[model samples]
Each structure stands twice: as structure tokens, then as C-alpha cells.
Target: MKLAMKYIILYVNDFDKTMNFYKEILGLPVKMQHDTYVEFDTGATTLSINTRESIKEIIGLEMPASSVASQTFELGFVVEDVVATIEMLRGLDVPIYKEPVTKPWGQTVAYVTDPDGHYIEICSAME
Candidate 1:
């Protein structure tokens, strides 16, 4: 038997805010939504935003808050232009965690945070 990853569920404090952020800002189309869960089509995989309390029930333990101020992981996107993407997200008033800069590996990258504190890194290695 082979195991395949289908989806990644992110614990969010406010489902609506997180959903809208992904839908409007990241441009991920919504696949479905319920009273406690929202799923977005991220091209290759499904990204889910669920209420923290509900996530706790699913994990059978107390879930920690995933806020912009306390992010643990980053959601990454490959873009054509990291600078332009940063400008667009900044125009949307999204908080910038890091300005666009070239990494030691020679990849242009930038970082931003979602409403619930998920870091999103926009990188372009096309150069």
C-alpha cells in the first residue's frame, strides 16, 4: 500500500478571516465550506482552515493558537516575481514578515503572514 498526502488542515482562530485571506489574497479558489471548516484548492493540494476548538477535538488534545504573531510553519508559493507579489500583498494591507531579498541559495524570496498567523513565503527561482 502507498500513502499519499491529500490535504493539510490549519487550525485557525477565525475561519472566515482565514478563508477570505486565502481566497482573495492568495487567489486560492474555495472548494467547499461548512459551519466549522473551509477548504481551498491550492492547485496540487487542498488547504483547509478549521476552527481551533474543532481541531482540538480532532487531535484529541488542546490545540495551540496559530496567530500571525505566533506562527510555527510557513505556506510557500512559487511566484514569477517576488517583488511584484510583495507589492500586491502590501497593497492589500497584509503584514510583511520579510522584504523581498535574495537567499544564500540565490533564490528571490519574501514572507507574509495570514490572519491566523500562518507564514507564506513567495519565492522565485526562475532567474
Candidate 2:
């Protein structure tokens, strides 16, 4: 058997706000969109945003509560300059979870939160 990962779907409460954040803030190109679903082209993998109600209707079960306080998962992005990315995120008024810092492992990383409180780590390889 063979399997290939394709999409990471984030079930959101406010569909429009979440969709707009990915589209306007992160500047991801929209691959497809409908009343309840939106997909963004992020190179090899696609990032999809769906409404909780939509999932509930499809699965015929109540969706569990989603919380950012759990800190269980995050989306990471590799950039050329972590500091510059942090500065740009600050200018956009994005919530900063941690300031840019170089780790002992030779990576400069900074953390930020999206509108839905999902952590986004911006990092660059240390020279």
C-alpha cells in the first residue's frame, strides 16, 4: 500500500474570518473555494479551511471543541530571514507568541499565532 499526504484541513468556527486570514494575511493563493470550504495552494501540500458545521453535517456527529490553549499542534514555515519575517508579522499586527531567537541547534525561530490562535513558527537555518 502507498499513501501520499495532500491536505491539512483546519475546522474553523468563523469561516469567512479564517479564510480571509489565510488569503489576505498569509498571502496564500486560493486553489478553490465554496460556501463552506476553501483550499489554498501551498506548494506540495494544500491547506484547506472548513467550517465545523460542514464537518458535522458530513460526519453526522458533533465536532469536538477546538482550542488553541492546548498548544498541541502548529504550522511551520521556513523563511530566509526569521527576524525580517517577525518584523513583517509585527507590522501586520499578528500576535507574537515569541520573539526571534537563535537556538543552540543553529536555527533562528520565532512564533506567532493566527486569528484562530494556531501557532505559526517562522524559522531560518543559522549561518
lDDT, each prediction: 0.83, 0.84
The TM-scores of all predictions, comma-separated, are: 0.84, 0.87
Model 2 scores worst on lDDT over the 10 consecutive residues at 62-71
The CA lDDT at 63 in model 2 is: 68
lDDT of 1 at 121: 90
Q: Candidate 1, 34: how far from true, in Å? A: 2.0
Query: Which ranges in model 1 have alpha carbons more than 4 Å from their true place?
Result: 57-60, 65-70, 125-127
Q: Can you write out model 1's per-residue Cα lDDT over 9-109, one digit (the tens) per residue?
A: 88888877877788988898889988778888886778888888987787677887654445556788898889999999999999998999997889998
For candidate 2, write residues 16-123 as lDDT tens digits.
888777899888999998878899998898999887789898877776667543468888888998898888879989889999998999999999987678888999
TM-score of 1: 0.84
Q: State the lDDT at 37 in candidate 2.
A: 87
